[model samples]
Target: MRGLLKLTLTQMKLYLREPVATFFTIFFAPLMLLLFGAIYGNEPSPLFGGRGSMDVSVPSYIGLIIVTVGLIGLPIGTASAREHGVLRRFRATPLHPLAYIVSDIINYLLMTVLGVLLLFLTGKLVFNVRFEGHLLSVLGGFLLGTLAFFALGYLVAGLAPTARTAQTVGMVLAYPMMFLSGATIPWEILPKGIKAFAQYIPLTYVVRLMRGLWFGDAWSQYGTEVAALVGCLLVGGIVAAWTFRWE
Candidate 1:
C-alpha cells in the first residue's frame, strides 16, 4: 500500500508537469465556462427549462473534462510510457505490476476529481451556478461516466501501436465527441440533425446523464443513459484487459 501511494504520487507529479495534460484536464473547462458565462450571462432561459445557462453548462462541462483526460491524457500517457519502455522498467522494480497500474488509475482519478472541483468552484464563485440535485447522486453519475470513459481510454492505449498513433486516434475520436456530445455546446440549441447524430456518440450518454442528474432528476429517469455508460465500461474494460501490453 505504501509503495502504491508513492507510485501514485509520482505519477501525479509527472502528469502535472505535462503542460497539455495540465491545461486541458484542469484549466480548459473552467476557462470555457468563464468565456461562455460572460457571453450568456447565466440568465434563466426557457430553452433550459428555466435554469440559468451556467447552471446547465457547469454539469455538461464535466463531461468535457472527462473526455479530455480519458481520451487524450490517459491514452497518450500510457502509450508514451510503453513506447519509452517505462512500463517494462516498472516490471523490474520490487513492487508488483498491479501496483503500477493501480497507481496510474489513482493518479488520473484524483486529477479528475480535482479538475471537477475547480470547475465547480469557478462556476459557483463567478457565475453562481445552481445545483438542484443531491450531491451523492451527482457524484455517483460522475464516477460512472468517468469510469466508462477511462475504460475506453485504456482500450485506445492498448490497441494503438505507438504513442503517436494513440494520440492521433484519441484526438480524432475526442474532438467530434466534444462538439456533438453537448459537452461544449448545449444540446437544446443544437440542430435536429446534429442531435440525432449525437445520440450515437458514447459521450452523449455521459452528457445526458450528467445534465439530468444536475437538474435534480431521479436516477430512474436516466435508465437508458446509465445502461449505455455501463455497457461502455464493461465492453471497453474487457477489451482493454485483453489487448493491454506492458512493452
Candidate 2:
C-alpha cells in the first residue's frame, strides 16, 4: 500500500510539474466542447425523438470528450514514457508500478470532472444550457467510460514500441473511435449500418450510456452500452496486462 501510494504520488507530481501537458489535457476537450456547443448547441436536438431542443447536448458532448481525449489519450502518453525508459525505471524501483498507471487514471478522473463542469458552466453561463439528468448518473457513466478507455490505452501503451508509433497509432485509433462512438458525430445522425457497427465499439456504448444519463433517459434505455463498457474494460485489461513490456 505504501509502495502504491508513493508511486501514485510520483505520477501525480509528474503531471503537476508539467503544466503544459496538464493544461492541454484538461483544456482541449472542453475547448472542443465549447466550439461544438457554440455551433450545434444553438440548433434543435435533431434526433432520438428529443424535445424541442435547447442546450441539452452540452453535457453529453462534454461527457463524450472526457472519455476520448482524457481516457483514450492516456496510453499514448504512457507509451512515450515507456520509450523513454520511465516505465522500465519504475519496474526497478520499490514502488508499485501498476500504481503509477493508476495515478494517471486518477488524474484523468479529476480532469474529467473539471472538463465536464467547465463545459456545463460555459454553456450555462454563456448559452443558457441546462441539464435534466442527475450529475451522479452522468458521472457514473463517465467513470465507467473512463475505465473502458483506460483499458484500451494500456493496450496501446503495451503494444506500441516507439513514442512516434504510439502517437501515430493513437491518432489513427482515436479518430475512428471518436467518430463511430458518436463523439465527433452524433449516432442519431448516423446511418443504420454505422450505428449497428458502432454498437460493437466500446467507446460507442460509453457515449450512448453517458448521453442517456445526461438526458435522463431510463436506466433500462442503455443496457447494451453499460454491458459493452464492462466487457471492454475486462477484455482490454487482460490484453494490456499480457502485452505490457518494460521497454
Candidate 3:
C-alpha cells in the first residue's frame, strides 16, 4: 500500500512537471469553452435539446478531458518511460508492474477530476450554466467512463514500442473518438450515418451517459450506455493486462 502511494505521488509529480501537460490540464477545457461560449452565447437552443450550448458543452468537454488523458497522455507517458528504461529498471525492484501501472492510473484519474471540476466551476461562473441531475449519478458514470478509457490507454501503452509511436497511434484513435463522440461536435447535429456509426463507438456511450446524468436524465435512462462502458472497461483491461510489458 505504501509503495503504491509513493509511486502514485511520484507519477503525479513527474506528469505535472511537463509544461504541455500542465497547460492542457489547467487551461484546455476552459479555453475551448471560452472560445465557443463567447461566440454562441448562453441562449437556450433547440440545437442542444433546448438547454444553453454551454450546458452540453461543459459535459462534453469533461468527456474530452477523460478521453484525452487516457488515450493520448497515458500512452505517451508510459511509452516514454519504457523507452527511457524506467519500466525496465523497476522490473528488478520489489515493486510489482501492476503497482506501477496502477499508480499511473491513479495519478491521471486525479488530474482528470481536477480538470472536470475546473471546467464545471468556470461554466457556472462565467457562462451561467447550472449543473443539473443527481451529483452521485453523474460521478458514477464519470468514474466508469474514466476506467474504460484508462484501460484503453494501457492497451496502447503496452503495444507501442516508443513514445513517438504511441503519440501517432494515440492521435489516430483519440481524435476520431473526440470528434464523433460529441466531445467536440454535438452528436445531435451530426448526420444520420455518422450518428449510426457513433452508436458503435465506446466514447459515444460515455459522452451520452455523462450528458444525460449531468443534465437531468434518469440514471435508468442510460442503461445501454452504462453497459457499453462497462463492457469496454472489461475488454480493454483484459487486453492491456495480457499485452503489458515491463520494458
Candidate 2 RMSD computed on C-alpha atoms after optimal superposition onto the true structure: 2.9
Answer with 1 or 3, whichever has the higher lDDT: 1
Q: Which candidate wins on TM-score? A: 1
Query: Candidate 1, residues 1-247: lDDT per residue as tens digits?
Result: 9999888998999889988889999999999999999899999999999989999999999999999999999999999999999899888879887788788888999899989999999999999999988999999999999999999999999999999999999999999999999999999988999888888799999999999998889999999999999999999999999999999
Rank by lDDT (best first): 1, 3, 2
Question: Tens-digit lDDT track for model 2 on 129-187?
Answer: 65778877877778888777778777777787777776777677777877787765766
CA lDDT of each prediction against the hidden true structure: 0.93, 0.69, 0.87
Q: What does candidate 3's lDDT look like per residue over 75-108, in tens digits?
A: 9988888889888998898987778777888899
| Candidate 1 whole-model C-alpha lDDT, 0 to 1 | 0.93
Q: Positional deviation of 100 in candidate 3, in angstroms?
A: 1.9
Please name the candidate that would achieve the greatest lDDT relative to the true structure. Answer: 1
Candidate 2 stretches greater than 4 Å from native: 1-10, 16-24, 41-56, 70-72
Candidate 1: regions farther than 4 A off: none
